[model samples]
Target: MTTPRPAAPSPTDALPGGLGRRFSWRGRQIAWTAFGDGPPLVFCHGTPWSSWLWAPYARALSAQFTVHLWDMPGYGASSMLPEHDVDLGVQGEAFAALLAHWGDGWGEAPHVVAHDYGGAVSLRAALLHDARYASLCLVDVVALRPWGSPFFRLVRDHAPVFGRLPPAVHRGALEAYVGTASHRGLRDDELEALVVPWLGDAGQAAFYRQIAQADERYTAELEPLLGDLDVPTRVLWGEQDTWIPADRAGRLSAALGHAEARLIPDAGHLIQLDAPVALATELRGWLAEVGAGRR
Candidate 1:
């Protein structure tokens, strides 16, 4: 039986490094935690992972920048989107709305840090609404191609069938996919932490529904738009990313025209988890290099 999910953390937490949580957007409860007291840097996590994935980096970067993190819809503490056909379009619109809200009242555009699916979401925001971003740090992002795990292909083809299977099949497939993509593998607590949020029927349905919305054409759109993007963009990659081949790093840089790529020697698909300090240092340096310091 599923126990009550833990109460989401409050906007103001007792943790060190400038922490706050429970930020709302349009009455939709979005679990947001921020740290530091400088120019804002918003972080967006990839699929199956929530904002909690970036907690370490948020803690480290809080010293130099006010780090903002949010659980995307259907993940972490945020409410799932009501629509069943949630795609990049819907997600992009929501993200655009967030940036517009931030620009109007919260503060000026913040430097965006994104990973994997977050990268795509961030790019969508930047391409359509460039005014809300100061700079970008995209890591393990999908771009310029249709590179994805074989498992993703399976999901794309079989979600309708597998999505209807008994709870055990659903649970097993989710666990296996998570295991295959995770480079260093997750500990028991870590696995439970990530898996617990998606255990119920609502959560499972949302997961499949969202997955169905990802269109490979989104990557193609980035290729043409990257050249026109004025915001100084940078790429970070795990040297040994299994899910997204390491070779794609070069492709992304070349396609972006003005972006630089950094390969973290021993990191994997989850760069923030594998090398928090190194990632933070690189980001801080980039922030400084690009004048992304507190405004």
Candidate 2:
């Protein structure tokens, strides 16, 4: 059966500081936003979160680089595909398509800053396409083995049950899940932005759909290709990250030929929320090291 297209985003869907755009990919609409004007810097966010996570960082870095932020196929403003269509492999393909789409106007090979599940997507994209990125920053990404939290496992095992949860039940669960990602709890507004997208029927279903589709095979497939990357890479982790431990950053760095894995103290998995300034500073330094131009 053919997949149904999602409703196009209206002006109201645009975040406070970023403009939203949509692109077609494998019969699904992917939502993205671009800000500032310089070398391209793409931000890929993680599970139960969307491009909204990058708004503050985008503003901070946009002064120097054109920041591109997107909701992966099943999250945020993007279309919620069938559960099977939201796996890591498909997400990689979607990123590849998005990169090619971006290339038409932003000609430079873009720099990438990916977080959480986005790490797997970014890694697979680079491996499958040899995508010519200037530099890559992975923050609390799920790139190593034995990943996935206890909550993730429970949801994965009972997706159908959880997907049918009432809106209030889902909201409580979402807030609780998001709370675990940061050492310092999110502000009311921060929590609202993160939770809003997963609130209604479609949103709640998409939440469980993503968890159900989680698989290690995607990252496992890229394991052999990890050391073969030629692009400069930096792995960043929150010292207090509970979802994916900080040690995975060290392993990821070693796997990528001794690239440094810098730890941000007093931060957790949601570094963008917990410490946007520190994350932005680190990103600026990485861009400078790679000689990516800034205005």
**lDDT leader:** 2
Candidate whose TM-score is highest: 2
Instruction: Please provide, for model 1 over 164-241, each residue's C-alpha lDDT reduced to its tens digit, 9 standing for 90 to 100.
Output: 868877877787777665667766555556566565687787677667667878767666887777788899998878
Off by over 4 Å in 2: 1-19
- Estimated TM-score for each candidate: 0.86, 0.92
Q: For candidate 2, lDDT tens digit of each residue in 46-105?
A: 887888777777777777888888888888878875633798988998998889999999
**What TM-score number comes out for model 1?**
0.86
lDDT for model 2, please: 0.84
10 residues in a row with least lDDT, candidate 2: 5-14
Listing every candidate in turn, what is its Cα RMSD in Å to the true structure after a full C-alpha superposition? 4.0, 6.0
Backbone clashes in model 1: 4
Candidate 2 backbone collisions, by pair: none
